[model samples]
Target: MASSGFCSLGPTVTSLFSSHALARWRSSSISPPPLRISRALSAATTVPISSSFTWDDVIETGREEYTPHNSSDLTGFLEKVNRCNRASEKLAEFIPFVIEEQIVGYIHKGFTEYLREFHDIFTFSQNGSCPDRVDGFVTLNLMLEKPEDRTRAVADVIKILGDKGIIPGIRNELYPVKPSFNAPVFFSLERAAAPYFGIKGYGVHMNGYVERDGQKFLWIGKRSLSKSTYPGMLDHLVAGGLPHGISCGENLEKECEEEAGISKAIAYRAIAVGAVSYMDIDQYCFKRDVLFCYDLELPEDFVPKNQDGEVESFKLIPVAQVANVIRKTSFFKANCSLVIIDFLFRHGYLLISPTISLSKETSYLRLYIPDFNALTLKNLLVLDLVMMII
Candidate 1:
């Protein structure tokens, strides 16, 4: 599972003038007004947005001039990868959340104080000496052994917490709780509280692109400013959390139609390319997410319209320009950065030498299927190696 950070760099502008304009300005007896120079300077600098930078505004300013080739900007890409994986030092603050002797999540020592209030639902065990070690584990009451019972008991506690604003933005959607993706569901947890409980979450993110005149253009969505999270940021054409009771493919197809108005016929064409994982700790939230990635090629004539109001607008941007926007600005939602980077690697747009040394500070891992047609098996292997190094 991977996470991300948000950064925004303001607009950039580059100015060119005909000899006539230059001569006119030079010959002017009156000084060129200060406002004109100020406006010109503003146009030359990138305009930053609330969550990210605008691609079209920055692209025209020749922001990519620093690294003409996208492949040569590994350092910028690494910055993005680093933002998604953070706060490893705080891992000791959390204890395992176990069910049936199998650990399913982590609970922060601070947040566990709330769980202590619900003795009927949670049981705490002390098994180690060190205070900061994973010396203790939290479990469901043994009497509530059945999945249904456990789920209800947990749901009641979540409601109390939600009322207290401890767990804000409760989506009412259910997310499965288990040891792994394929494991049988032990119970279901409210989607918003999953992070607070340190539960491993999953989501699907798809890159919708069009191959036009030998160049690839990606459909990028501008998230609605009213969104609870990452409002007004750039996002993939389609993305959503992996709610309970749905396969990844099915979830992606549903999200594709809802988020971008793509029909099932086109959504089904999305190839499951790979997955990215990361663990992030911020205060009481321990976000461990694994995002399944997909790439769908759309017809040149297709223009996406959001059926759901989650998206405010959409634009088709050249893949190379998109790479610049990501590397140079924090306009894309952080987790979306990982998926797009994976897309770049698969499409031969990102070139990283195997011998390049990765510092220990970077924490991210990507697993790929060897046979994905988006790239040759060997290329995927090499790309996986590069991701592993980071």
Candidate 2:
């Protein structure tokens, strides 16, 4: 009886195995259906992807598709300023103010009342209802007899504005008064009103970077919450505006000490990479400024200590994360974004992809570097060399 039962079980097991094998063969013979291309993808093939980006993308217009709180504000401000400039017509209608042969500022016909009120401070070439624009400029003779006189004049202007409540208060910071971008300093002006007059300002920004385990990191500083402008905003490791009577190198060293507590020996190691320039205009002021950028590689053991109360804290962030912040957030000071973008380009982090347009790349390469015309041929050559080295 046992032998008969074993024989019956063997036949049942063999039948089940044959059915499973047949199912596996059928499954193996069937292939995955071809993937269907959607209409959207088919349309995408006709449009070429952009390979290049321009300075307008990141610097001028701010990044697209990620509108920060200030993006619209900046755009609106620029639009208003441009519209005001366009409404004014021929050169004769506008008052051209020259500094050492170049027209730096223009006073609109609307500001005639203010000009008349301050006529004592101005020396006109002719005396009449309307003075002829000399060489396309109605030069305002700021009868600055002495250096101290210029200071007093600037102070008096501030006082007049403050008395009328046009300006809230006077900031003690003094800015070098240049006729144009790189013209020699004619006098000093109050920092608060410098942009209001369309004066060109200079500043220095130091890029402090570290290498750890084959990755690059940047040393970023956060402005103190109590600071007046862009309070609590992110800043470069060391940055300061060029005050009157100080050279760029000297100002850089001083800022390194004051802002980051770096000794002169170490701070002087910073290499001048390049400069970034931009013109920002709003209802209140017009800012045409340039930042002299430097690259400094710090040792792994080195840490920054803020000597001035302006900085709240220091942080070491990876370069990738820093780029993300610039692209997605308005945490950084307006000009600081340009400096970081310059650093990324110099360090090869920002590259020209195959889809980027050649024209766009060329436009970015021609960054609005202020004072390029002011640079001597030799100096320009040297600058090109330094940029190549970067």
Candidate 3:
């Protein structure tokens, strides 16, 4: 659980006017963008957690567990519910709190079921306040799905959270399973960039947070990206995630070409790859096992033509213009809109900086590199320079 503060910093652009290169992104270009924004704001921090404990073990202690592809997992889950009520009965303190229990106790005193719940408590609780009262327990969404293969369920949860922010942005939600995974063995098979410690393989992605006329426009998607767990459905502005790694730099070029419809030149022109968020999509929250954010910017007129039907349409909405629309919009489908927005607002491109404009600024940065004037024969990271270490 973390704070909801959106920010980003990458190549900046000033002009919001149309560009010749961006002619194909209008409503008449192809089909309209069909994405919606997500409303959930609490950041879902996917820490590595394991819920390998079983019902038997939980009954002994106040803990629960779920094993992948196991029938007993369900029985154990139910037992947790029973235990919640038992906890209330056993303790005279903190009994029958929250709206649900209050109503339940009033309606039926001898309850047959337990409303067991789990939450990742934040320093400041869900309402953004450190609870002055220790007697009250927090309530969260039940979020249940019909029985399915463990892998399938995990994917569904990822889609659900990504598309609709089903998981609260900053709240502590229960981890039904432990978080763990082997980095795809295939990842280490790549050959290029291997000299740069652990660069056996690499992946690529882009984060497009745009602003127009002093108002930020979060491009959203209405359709679930194709080849995704939720196949052909509504989702976030940045729908793509965790692409397979190809050659060291080749993967980024391919992803931008395929997903964002940007030329390789433009992709190179606007690369801002960096580590942004901590995620455990595989076991903790669901979807691609892990992902890091990359930032990309272009002329305001740049419109993406999704080739694979992954993105149905795009909607450009005002930045501060979010509330019910986040939940209501289909484009901000990746439940991470708040996360994305927080990142953008905090570290997003500096369009109108202290003195410079975005394009001119980018031009300067592209041509300039850290000076080689430093007295260093051992500076190995200095690109394009062959220095002899004495």
Candidate 4:
């Protein structure tokens, strides 16, 4: 939905990398040149260089045309799967519950069985349906008796699902159940069940990048092959879910320390950038998750040591090479690609051309920001421009 006006600026802006930086990047042999490099270096002579840059630069240097890469694969992965088939349509049978007219979570049609199985912890409409029929469509609701009882009820549900083998890879982690992102928590749910019930999940992703010899290098990790999800795939330096009762900052610091052995003081220096959201639906589950993104600049001498067994190894790769890996191979977790793309755009590595159609840009931006209902045409164009840059 990006505007044509903003999209037209693609060819006007100059290169984001200065001649000196480009020289170092090329010398490193991390990736091939994106465009034909002119021998002229006069344009870059007056540009100031600094390791400590601001987001204002991202906003300022927002015009350029970039050569395309294999980023289309990410677009295809995020396109909404057709649900017109009977099996997929069955997901519509569950109705979402609204509190203060905002969607909280869905109540499965079979929730009556749960009410009967755990009558002490659930309350259902006497008519077997909601009274209002619009705002109150859910047939069953969790009885919020006490703060402590909420965890107990979630435990019971986890036990029931475990016994039936309904949920996979239960991590024993707890996720808060709220009416909305800013709403008060009414109860808690097991991490695995959150997707099954279409609940919102939160997580954090920290990008560890460094400037060495005037070139940008990123620290990338390989997930352990034994991981239940995306095993052996590339991942950010430090990432983890926001568990129940923990703030985003706290969860990020914890993950930084645990996953990459970053000290608390160093981890606190990470800059909280923004968030990316997506809703993924498969045959048996639905996930509407959001990741809070952070960028941490590491010292040239710092070497990341994985304390958690989840990471197999770490590699220091140039930014362009990282972009190529994301574009050419399915080596990264699907969602991690979004985070990296965001970083690329924010840092001025990616730029979109005006020649590409709006539809193509829309498809690509959807991968990073799945829920684009509220995005304006200008915003969509900006994101599309960013993706096209990659």
Instruction: Compare the candidates by TM-score and give the number of the best one.
Output: 1
- The C-alpha TM-scores of every prediction are 0.80, 0.65, 0.35, 0.67
Which residue pairs in model 4 clash with each other? 1-377, 2-377, 2-381, 3-377, 351-389
> How does model 4 fare in lDDT?
0.56
Query: Between candidates 3 and 4, which one is better according to lDDT?
Result: 4
Sorted on TM-score, best first, the list reads: 1, 4, 2, 3
Give the lowest summed-lDDT range of ten residues in model 1.
35-44
What lDDT tens digits, residue by residue, belong to model 3 across residues 134-240? 33332223332221233243343334443554332322121222111112221111111111111111122345657666655555444533433334433343433
Q: How many residue pairs clash in each candidate?
A: 17, 5, 53, 5
* Tens digit per residue, CA lDDT, model 4, 1-390: 321110110111111112242244334422222321101100001111122322232223222222235344333223211110113234455555443334556555565354357666554443424322432343234455564676686578767877788676888888987754555776678887787666777788989999988878889888887888777767899998888887777887889888899988888778655556555446545566767677899989889998879998787877766766554445566678678866775675554443433331122222222112332111211122222324
Can you write out model 2's per-residue Cα lDDT over 1-390, one digit (the tens) per residue?
001000100000111011233244334433322211100000001111121332233233332332222233222212222322221113233444444444455444444344456766654444333322433333444566565676677578667876776655468888876554445566677887775555667788889999999878899888887876767777899998888887667888899999998888888777665565544445445565766777788889889999989998888877766765565555667677667766765565543222221221111111322222333111321111011111
- Worst-scoring 10-residue span by lDDT in model 2: 37-46
lDDT per prediction? 0.70, 0.54, 0.29, 0.56
Candidate 4 minimal-lDDT segment of 10 residues: 37-46
Clashing pairs in 2: 50-355, 51-355, 51-356, 52-356, 52-357
Residue 241, candidate 2: alpha-carbon lDDT: 89
Model 4 per-residue lDDT at 270: 80
